[model samples]
Target: MPSVFSALPGAVLDDSGLLHLGSPLVEQRRLAAGEAIAPLGDRAVIAVPGEDRLSWLDSLTSQALTRLDPGVGTELLVLDPQGHVEHAASVVDDGETAWLITDRGDAEGLLAWLRKMRFRLRVDPRAADDEFAVVGGTRSALARVVPATPAGRPLVWIDPWPDVSPGGYGYAAVDPHPGADRDWAEAIVTRDEERRIADAAAAGDLVLAGLTAVDALRVAAWRPRWTTDVDERALPHELDWMRTAVHLDKGCYRGQETVAKVHNLGHPPRRLVALQLDGSDSVLPVHGAAVRVGDESVGTVTSAALHYEEGPIALAIVRRSVAVDAVLTVDTSDGVISAAQEVVVPPDAGRTANIPRMPRLSRRASAQ
Candidate 1:
């Protein structure tokens, strides 16, 4: 199938001021391969205020939130008691409050879960408005478009230029087209969706992409999306999500014991490895397809795609015991698909190597 992520789509503004970024779902029907298919922006934000924000979040996530700077953003994970991830997202703060942007479908449910676990803490938890928006394109077009939100929360509202981002419920001042009115091209998915954007870009509104384009972009960026690279039962160390999400020394969270245990000494549970699938007829493996070393099932394919840049690629959760040169087969209904495993990290960095005991963290080191 042709990949939609390969090229940007087209749209035009009518004389009446309506801008049309041709609906990918409506016009194209089936999404093109690799298209970023979602309406616009997967970026999510959660706000935490009051005095206990840092400690509260530090206890909830796998990262050391205390060290995270106000302006910078880092990825972190919320793990279930069993050590599986409950939610995954970027953690950003601005001194007063902390913002968490997570996977789309899981945000609300995860927020509800966090609320249930809020035992006697001064910190409040909830999904921040999804109203966050992104403006991508030429700088000349957005020169006049100043960000219109207060500090802490990003400057979301786009001024001077036009073209509202897709999703629900937000208005912006945009040029939608050559001379389109700012209001005419505006879109609203839900009230929350509009609040998710940080600043405005000049690209205007691109069409809503299907799942296809998103997969391609994922491979190109080596961005490990949820479920694809992680399993709830798996430890955070296995997948190396610490860069953005897991705070290396954030105090005790729900699964902090396991995270700390895995980080200091014992090897991680499993490793998330990228794959290059072989053959034209061999389709990308579906989630849960058994990956084999000869006949033994060593892992399962969590996410796969026929990428525009890389013909076929996937993310798989494989046992740490699997050999470095392991050649695995994905057992799909159609047939077996062959792929080579390429390990991104090993136990030393984050992946666990079954050899030593859990290491201890110094109080100073655990501050974050």
Candidate 2:
């Protein structure tokens, strides 16, 4: 389906239909101020409807969803047997249905996995991208334009980042986390509502931002995204994702052992960091660019953007062995740009268990 946002003036869309309406920096400021909304063409929705929806999802993912109350927003992760993140979604239940919002590129695979997991369960998971579109902005901005009870209740997924959710643990020990001020939410709207939003923007009644602006704000928030942050070896602990996505006390699910083992006995092999890049060259390093410590490669940049307040910032997944104070550089197409690291996940991020250590024996006792 064609995006209704494509009709708005100054709308420049990428192949995936994400809009960059001429001025992304300006859009970022406006969106952050709760004066604009961004059309999220890169997002997709899945609908799970059945009596067993909540319990079924709880048993399958890394969250305690069995008692997920209506209209309460949370997120979940599908981990591989090794506790590597395979899929993730922002979740919200509207009593009768559970809406799973994820990156558009991963929606089909996630939906298929959900369907395959349903063995005689009353749950039916199906793609709902054709029926709904996502609009992202502050909660108040979204409320003004989106119908609150379009589907009997608000279908907004409020981000719960930088917060240690119930049964979750905080690894980023930083004071005043970067995402503290991020008031972002994504609202699921019907096609007709999408058109209405487009019309309002076209008529100068509503201000619209673009994916570029949205991403800038997200990167500044130290928010780890599925497409940019996850790799074959990516673990929830490595990205500080356990703070929001994983319930440490949740019942057994796929990868629960690994999650417990890492949190209780071992530290994550890698850690996520926020990099303050040198803006003198005005070039943001692209994703997957190698991060270097002096002469050796230490990590790869995951997400990078030029922010409205902060000049240029990026998120990188570096080896946990890398010194926290080490000066890092990114190998971009332009040149090796220097980056000052802000720890998102510290090197000592795991081993959260309070196991008591055995008292040491004295040398005299050993002789005896």
Candidate 3:
């Protein structure tokens, strides 16, 4: 179904929904100031309802979910056996069901995996995208626009990024993390409500931001996203995701061993960095654009945007050995552009354990 947001004047939509509305910069300002909301058409919802839902999910993901409280928002990651991220979701339980909000492209795969893993468990996970749409903005902005409460509790997921969640670890060492001021949340609304919100936007009663403005704010906040930042070999450590997603003391899951080993004794092979791109050429590098150190390719740009306050900014995953102070270049369609690196995950991000060293004995002393 075509998004009702496309009905607004100057709105341009892609396969997902509203990409922009002609004035992305202005939209960004309004959105950040709590005067606008963005329709998250690229996000999908999954409803997991059953007697054993929380415990079943607790056994399958990175977060400790067995005791998840009603209306509290958290995130979880499903990993491959090797600890590579396979799926990620924002979770909120309404005392009866756990709602999983994930990327639209990942919804089918995640649902299939959940169904396949339900071995006589009471949980039933089903796609809820047809019934609900996601809307994102500041907490206050959403409060002004009431969200759906089909079960008598507002369906909202508050982001926990840049904070060390209970049983979770943090890798970023910067004081006052860039995401500290990000007051973001997502609300699940009925399809009828989505149309009504769009109508209000069309009538100038409500302000609407687009995905472009949303991405800009996200990049500025140093937020990692599932669709844009994750790759086949991506790990929570590499993306500084330990701050919110991985529970260091959680019970065993598919990738728990690797997650523990990396944090305690080994370093992740890659590290995430924020890039302040040179905007002289006015071209933003696309995803997979090579990040270079001198002439050597060191990484690939994951997400890039023209932020309202920061100009051109991007997030990239680079080899762990890359110098934090390295002046890098990014290959764009227009040309190669210079970028300065701001470390998100340091090269020494792992090996958090304090193992004691054993004394070595000399051969002569051992003979005695």
RMSDs, each prediction?
Answer: 13.8, 8.5, 9.2
Is candidate 2 or 3 superior in TM-score? Answer: 3
lDDT of each: 0.51, 0.86, 0.88
Question: In candidate 1, where is summed lDDT lowest over 10 consecutive residues?
Answer: 166-175
Q: How would you order the candidates by lDDT, starting with the best?
A: 3, 2, 1
Q: After superposition, how far is residue 34 of candidate 2 from its true place, in Å?
A: 0.2
- Checking candidate 2 for backbone clashes, the offending pairs are none
Across 1-368, the per-residue lDDT of candidate 2 in tens digits comes to 66777767788998667558888899999999999998899999999999999999999999999999888889999999999999999999999999999998888889999999999999999998778888999998987676435458989888888788999987876566767788998998888898888888899898999999999899888888898899999999999899899999979999999999999899999999888887463688988999999989999999988878777788999999999789899988788988878777877778752322322211112212
Clashes of 2: 0
Say which candidate scores most in TM-score.
3
93-126, model 3: which lDDT tens digit per residue? 9989999999998899999999999999999999
Error of 2 at 138 (Å): 0.6
Number of backbone-clashing residue pairs for each candidate, in the order shown: 54, 0, 0
Rank ordering of all candidates by TM-score, starting from the highest: 3, 2, 1
